[model samples]
Target: GEFGKVEEVKESLDLAYMIKETQNLFKGIVEGSSRSMQIVKDLRTFSRIDEIDGVIQFMCNPCGKLSE
Candidate 1:
């Protein structure tokens, strides 16, 4: 039947569209996760630098007081 053939074609096209959309969604998720990981990495690096700076300041304070 011609009508049956038309319906089958429509179903196939819909399935293809869904597959494409799903792939795009997954790609976006991966990109977003990568960005989030990078942000966390940067935050950790900044925190470490802040800790080092604090230690340096603490070590210098006693010397400053002795000089005063």
Candidate 2:
């Protein structure tokens, strides 16, 4: 059955293409998510640098001026 064989090949190729496309999409999403997470972390760290330093100094000071 030449037609049957041709149909089977076409189906196989289509299935493989779909799988490849899905895998690529997932990979892109994961990469983008990880990059976004890294950017958020960096921003948070940068924002907190001064606050963290001030907090540490407050902790070192027994006067507890942070109540103000």
Candidate 3:
């Protein structure tokens, strides 16, 4: 009876560990996706610098002339 109880506990512990690992995997996926979305947003923002008349370019490059 004691041996059977030990086996059950071991199985339960294994299941718990698997669940924790799955949760961690999902968390990493979400974080990676958020970072990717931010990169895309930043790219769009910089791409629109042409529409803003070189304001961003001036800020990034001090030597560049800023249009009045």
lDDT of each: 0.85, 0.84, 0.86
lDDT of 2 by residue, 1-68 (tens): 99999999989789878889999999999999999999999988966884766765665566965554
- Which parts of model 3 are misplaced by more than 4 Å? 1-13, 50-68
Across 1-68, the per-residue lDDT of candidate 3 in tens digits comes to 99999999989789888889999999999999999999999999877975578666767667876566
| Candidate 1 lDDT tens digits, 1-68 | 99999999989789888889999999999999999999999999977886877864556575656444
Best candidate per TM-score, number? 1
Best by lDDT: 3
Q: Candidate 1, overall lDDT?
A: 0.85
What TM-score against the true fold does each predicted structure earn?
0.61, 0.55, 0.56
lDDT of 3: 0.86
What's the lDDT for residue 31 in model 1? 100
For residue 36, give model 3's deviation from the true position in Å. Answer: 0.4
Better of 1 and 2 by lDDT: 1
> Between the candidate structures 1 and 2, which one is better when assessed by TM-score?
1
Candidate 3 weakest lDDT stretch, 10 residues: 58-67
Better of 1 and 3 by lDDT: 3
